[model samples]
Target: MSASSTRPSYAAVLRMPYATRTFTAALAARLSYGMVSLAVMLAVSRATDSYTAAGVVVALFGAASVFLSPLRAALVDRHGPRRALLPMASLYAGLLGALAAVSWRPGAPVPVLAVVAVAAGACTPPIGATMRAVWGELITDRRLLQRAYSLDGVAEELLFVSGPLLVGLMTGFAPPAAAVAVSALLVGLGTTAFVASPAVKGVAVHVARAGARTRLGRGLVQPVVVAAGVGLSLGAVDLLVLAFAEQRHHGENAVAWVLAALSAGSAVGGLLNGAVDWRMSARLRLPLLAVGLALALGVAGLAPGLVTLSAAVAVAGLFVAPALTTSYLLADESAPPGGRVRAGTWVNTAVNAGSSAGAAAVGLLVGRLPLAVCFAASGAVALVAALVSWHGEASPDVRTGEAAELVR
Candidate 1:
């Protein structure tokens, strides 16, 4: 049978022209992100002989990567991924290699490691945002885009899950530095393949000046706000879950399984969301999804046992993917022509920043408040964002305009 006749599933998304090759390359490069954190932490600890120094280095790396992501994405939108991403991937990979070399032996200066980590993080390729923008370029049918984004989200979830496992395997037979080096190789090779794609090469480069003059509409605001809320809750949930396990005196394995269940639920939810046809407009759907997630997390806190808690957390997971997918969909709808990458990066930046803030906030609160109260507060953060979004959707502009397209 012709590939064009592929059944209406996620398979159809991959079958789009140049979709398969481009997506495969992007995923290969992105796997490095998953492996990099663990490998870097291990390499730095052994090199500096201090976990505290290792953590500081890792935090610096993450701060540079997460906070500076939008600027790099803006560069890609202005220059096109080929001119922009190639140099970034090249330098990022090289830094990883240097990090590996220094971290291979003991007693590398902590300041030296910190500098390299920040440099590497700053240059890290904006593969995820670029891939999302590529999906925008490759597909215009709203449903197919939904499928593509859902598939992308699920695959990313799996990549992070498997990345650490791969690192563990490598470290068993070789030094942690080997995993770091492998991360470098993967991004270098994968990004090379990525830029060579006809679809990727075909991506439009906006005039930097025109892109600068154009402004994002209200359509972008709800998604970014809700995304931040989702991220904050999730970050708090991670630590809260750990506290839950500790309170019961449960082993580490118990925590692992519960977290795994959350990922599993998110994957399942993403697939299901892609397949369904929704009636609500994305502007409207955005708030409701957040409400569902917030409520589920609230329920999670009230559970009396691990099994019940896991079940509640799983329910929360179900909303996670759908909410984020809808946020991306909304961002795409709102972005100025050729600035899709930067717009999406804003949503990403909000989420990461929120996660960092949430973890820090909860880290302080968990020490003084009841665990159940902390979970409710975490959920409350999302609920407040949802309420604001609902109010925004009810505004005259949203109701009279833009509500015409119901993104699902």
Candidate 2:
């Protein structure tokens, strides 16, 4: 039977050694991150009596994290995830708890809340970076690494979708503060458990910084460019979702559905991208990205109802995670022996920045223009990004000496 025709069962996939333990660690870690995703927002907003102020706090947190990610990732590279995760996780939980407690108090100062947010953001646990570093350590084959990342992409989508949904429900039934507590506890417990996993503990981060002497720093350029393109596309799409929801006269719930649809699609796409064993050159792969994104964005314009819109969004999203996972894998291959985590961090940072810009611009345009216009414009932006990527030359492979691929 053809390998494509005779795919392994989920049970069979689960039986792979790295699949079981490493995936468990990833799940636990992601679940922890997901659990708190919205709880923190809810808590801050309640405590401050102003969602705007709370958003500022959250933004500050993200900003701090973006700045600190490289440093923390470097730590992960130098001293295994086990050594790096716990302390960072502890700081994250403690600050979150502090923010909750301070926000609850009647007389807590806004400035204090801002500081807490900064602290929280700064200590946001470079989970993606740490995980990517682990992936480089465990999964050796490039194809297998892609699959592993695809699985991770699924976990991430599920986390964002389910975490906020559950938190919203919890806050509605009980209280937002209670939800925050729950998230904090989960973050602490899950992070500790994942860090203690055998895979994470066994990792040996290169303490020395010798890798920077050669073309180590230069290694980041290609991946950063690719990541930026992907991020901008995603960001624009995210803004389009909000705009589309508002245009449809749908309630806030529409936003949730739209996001969930895109994320769900991306998750499925990651899996399919991972399973494919045949390698496609960058030249071929990059050009296809524009087509994938355009198709997805085009679907957004056809949003007759929530159901149809979601299906379209999902279809469009199918390209994001897999494309990103491939870029990340390529980044790993090009990274200096000791710079894998840092390389991953750079990718994350680039994507985050792109998303931020896309969301801002789309939000602005949607206010002044029609929903269809917004979607089309976003799609055009994504298509342009893909076109740019097509023009860039691929770099040489840097994995020749590595005995195994890094994964966790």
lDDT tens readout by residue for model 1, 14-42: 88888999999999999999899999999
- Best model per TM-score: 1
For model 2, the superposed segments whose C-alpha errors exceed 4 Å read 1-19, 105-107, 205-219, 302-305, 394-408
Report backbone clashes per prediction.
0, 14
Q: Cα deviation in Å at residue 241, candidate 2?
A: 2.5
Worst 10 residues of 1 by lDDT: 204-213
On lDDT, the candidate that comes out on top is 1
Tens-digit lDDT track of model 2 for 101-211: 887644567789889878877887777666776665665655556666667676777777788777878877765767666766777777776776666665543423422
Prediction 2 global C-alpha lDDT: 0.69
**For model 1, what is the alpha-carbon lDDT of residue 260?**
85
Candidate lDDT (C-alpha), each: 0.87, 0.69
Q: How many pairs of residues collide in model 1?
A: 0
TM-scores for candidates 1 onward, in order:
0.94, 0.86
